[model samples]
Each structure stands twice: as C-alpha cells, then as structure tokens.
Target: MIKPIVKDQQLLAKKAVPATKTDRPIAADLIDTLNAHQTECVGMAANMIGSNKKIIIARLGPLNVVMFNPQITAKSNPYQTEEGCLSLIGKRPTKRYQKITVKFFNQAWQPQTLFLTDFAAEIVQHELDHCNGIII
Candidate 1:
C-alpha cells in the first residue's frame, strides 16, 4: 500500500525504532511507496510513511535496495549537495560522505553489508537521516 507521507515536522522529528521481524510489512510498504513515486523520489524511509521503524527503500542505479536498521559503519570525504525530502519543503544544502560502508538487514531479515560511493552513497545517507529523525 502507498501510505500517506508524514509531513508534520513534529512527527518526522521523532526517532525511528529498530525494525524487527514483524516490521517486514513496513519495509514492503516503503518499497511500494517508492515505486509509486519513483519518478519523483529515489528513496523513502519508514518514518516518511508514518511508521517509526528503521526501514528504507532506495534505487541506486540498476539496484533497488530495501534495508532495515541501516547504519553507516564507515564514512569519509565529506561533500555538500542540495537535497529535498518528501517530508520537507524546498531543497537545502546538506553535507554527505562521498563514500560509506553500511550494515543492515535485507527484506528477508538476513544481515548484509554494502560499500557505497557517489550518488548511491548519497541516497543511502539521505534515507538514513530520516531513520535518525533528521530532515536534512
């Protein structure tokens, strides 16, 4: 289902909880929402859909990733870029790492680690910020 995006700052500001096995449905919903608005968005977070679970769906080039409890294990080379969010108004300058190593669980609940760089890295960082209740 394509859930309504939580645009309220008060709601979006709340930190998300770690996703558990039961939160798999929420991850699926995030993927559906992202696909529904793929032309306008490259990623989405669980909180964006009013769910306080640590889940995100990101389209990095040819890959579509659904992640839960995503954490940046390593990062380097900070860079500034303009970013916009489904839960916020207008684009803003945001600092993101050029390269990052992330650890998370896939949709199947299996642990996975990925090293990302360039645009893909940026997308992951953006979604992770939402998981942390950061709009930027």
Candidate 2:
C-alpha cells in the first residue's frame, strides 16, 4: 500500500542518487499525490517516495526528464521567492535560486544535464529538497 507522503517519513539523502525504473504503479501513485494536493507539477523518484534507488518522475510536459538517481551539479545563489510545497499546503514566500543545473543518469545509465528556470526551476528545487530531507 502507498503510504501517506508525510515527506519526513523518508529522508532525502545527501549523497548523489541512483535511478530506479519507475514502474507504472509508482508513477500512478505520484500522479495521485500530485493531484491530491492540487499540485500543478511534481518531480519524484522511487527513492524519494521511500525506495532507496535512483528513479525520477515529473509532471511537466515535453520535459519528460525521468532520471535515475539525479543530482544537482550546479546552482545559482539563493534570491528567495514565494514557494509552496505539497507537504505544506499553505505556504509563505521565500527566496530560492534564480537558476539551477542538474546532472543525472537516464534510465539508460547515460549521463544527462538539465537546465531550469522560473517555475520549473522552483519545482526542481522543491523536489530536490525532498531528496535531502528538506521542505520549503
């Protein structure tokens, strides 16, 4: 059974993560979680959901950047911005990075890089924060 995503239940590891193949069931649960919170987007991995392996899931179109055990290789200085998290429904604005770049192996184990800005940028930050047991 899928457990409630208290977010704190499974901590985000500080080390680089590996990718695990996200089966349809887990992906569907992520979708359900996203929808349950009325979240517009989500970036998740099997590990982030409680499994300790590299697998990622996102809800953005054309950005089907499902990665296995992804990590942020680069990020800009924090400038803070209004942010909300699925774990925390009502939220306050805070400063975050203006830009961030990540590197991770795809489902194929090939190295990949992704650059993000604006909403996606924040989304990545929020999701990655979960990887490190952080919530913003």
Candidate 3:
C-alpha cells in the first residue's frame, strides 16, 4: 500500500510511538511510499505516511534499509547543511553529523547496529528527527 505523503505540519510534528511487531505492515507501506517518491526523496518516516510509528526507511546506495525504533548511539564531526523533505515545502538549514552509529530492529525483529557516514548518516538523521517530531 503506497500511502500518501503527510503534509500537515501538526500531524508531522507529533512524536511517533515505538513500533511493535504488529506495526510490521507499516514498513511495507512505507517502502512503497518511498519508492513512489524516489525521484525527490531518499528516505521516509512512518509519520510521513500518517502513521506515528518510530519506523524509517532509507535508500542506501542500491538498497533500501528499514529501521524500527532507530536511535543514534554515537555521532561525530558535526556539520551544517540544508535539507528538503517530501512532507514539507522548500529546504531548511540544520545540523548533521558526518558519522553516526544507530541501533535499530530490522524487519525480522532482530536487533541491528549500523555505522553510517556522510549521506547515509544524514538521511538516517533526518528520518530520526521526524520520529522525534523535530521538523527541519
């Protein structure tokens, strides 16, 4: 199910809750939605599709990785940059780390830790912000 992109600021501003096993279906929907917007978007949060769950999907090179309840355990080399969202108009300036270590659960409900740098890290950070209700 390719869900519509949520543009309501109020709706996007609400913090997403932790995703349980039952929320598994939402990940598939999010992947469909992300694929639908691939031209202009590289990642998406569950909230972007109107479901306030702490889930995110990011395109890492040729692969699309889904993360459930992702948390940044470590980050380094802070840098300032501007970013645009599929759920918002125009781009906004924000801060991001050049490298980040995130802990999350995969689609199979197994724990996973990923080390990301540069654009991959940036993409994950942006989606994480959405889960936290921070629009940037």
Candidate 4:
C-alpha cells in the first residue's frame, strides 16, 4: 500500500511522459500504491501516485478504471459545480462538465476509449489535471 503525500508535500512539479515499456517494478509499485489509496467516491491521478505522467484511476460506484496519458479526446463543454481532492484539506466548489471522453491504455497496456457523464466525468477531469501539475 502506498501512502499519499498531502497537498503540502507536493514540492517539485513534473510533466507527463509517454507510456512506454514501463519497468515491472515501477508498475508494481504504482499498483500497490493505488490499491492502498482511499477515496470517498473520487478519482486519482498518476502524479498523486508518484509520477507526473498523464494517467489516472477513477472510482465511481463499482467501476475502477485506469487511464494512461488520458486526454479529453472529446468534451461537451464546461458546466459549473463543486470539486475537491484528497490532497486538498477539505472539499470545495468548482466547475466541471456534464460529459466527456478520453483515450488511454488498459492494464495490459492496450489502447482504450472511455465515455463518462455527470459526476464521473467531472472526477476523471479533476484527476487528469493533477497529472498535469494542476491543483484545482
């Protein structure tokens, strides 16, 4: 299990990397870290897990999806709402979209496409931002 560094712990910022033959040990560590993370119906990002790569793991309902270098391939425009993060000391309000689509890789390193809606879509976008040195 990986212990998450609080928002205050974020010191150096990094950019996203193209997912390539990532070493087994590193991937294992990431997975272990993810498995231990706790969120109350929220998503996570690669930077939050130890890498600044554009990747994320979203948890909503019974879904646990992994996104690699996930970019909003498509969006339905921004909508207003509240947003929060584990790194944040508390929950707050923010604006997000109603629908979104992204592209990424799966556990087997295979390409995949994802379509999201409502809060789930917002969660995905939030986590993806962390992968980009964003903290909003």
Per TM-score, the best of the predicted structures is: 3
- C-alpha lDDT (0 to 100) for residue 124 of candidate 3: 100
| Candidate 3 residue pairs in clash (backbone atoms < 3 Å) | none
Candidate 3 per-residue lDDT over residues 27-125, each given as its tens digit: 899889999889999999999998999999999999999999999999999999999999889999999999999999999999999999999999999
The residue ranges of model 1 lying beyond 4 angstroms of the native Cα positions read: none
User: What's the lDDT for residue 90 in model 1?
Assistant: 91
Ranking by lDDT: 3, 1, 4, 2
RMSD of each: 0.8, 3.9, 0.5, 2.6
Assess the local accuracy of residue 68 in candidate 4 as a C-alpha lDDT between 0 and 100.
66
The Cα local distance difference test for each model comes to: 0.90, 0.59, 0.96, 0.68
Q: Give the TM-scores of the predictions, in the order they appear.
A: 0.97, 0.66, 0.99, 0.80
What does candidate 4 score on TM?
A: 0.80
Score candidate 4 by lDDT.
Answer: 0.68
Using TM-score as the yardstick, the better of models 3 and 4 is 3
Deviating ranges (above 4 Å) for candidate 2: 1-4, 7-40, 45-48, 52-54
After TM-score superposition, the amount by which residue 83's alpha carbon in candidate 3 deviates from its true location, in angstroms, is 0.3
Q: Can you tell me which runs of candidate 3 are displaced by over 4 Å?
A: none
**Candidate 1 local lDDT, 54-106, one digit each (tens):** 89988988777999899999999998899998788899999999999999999
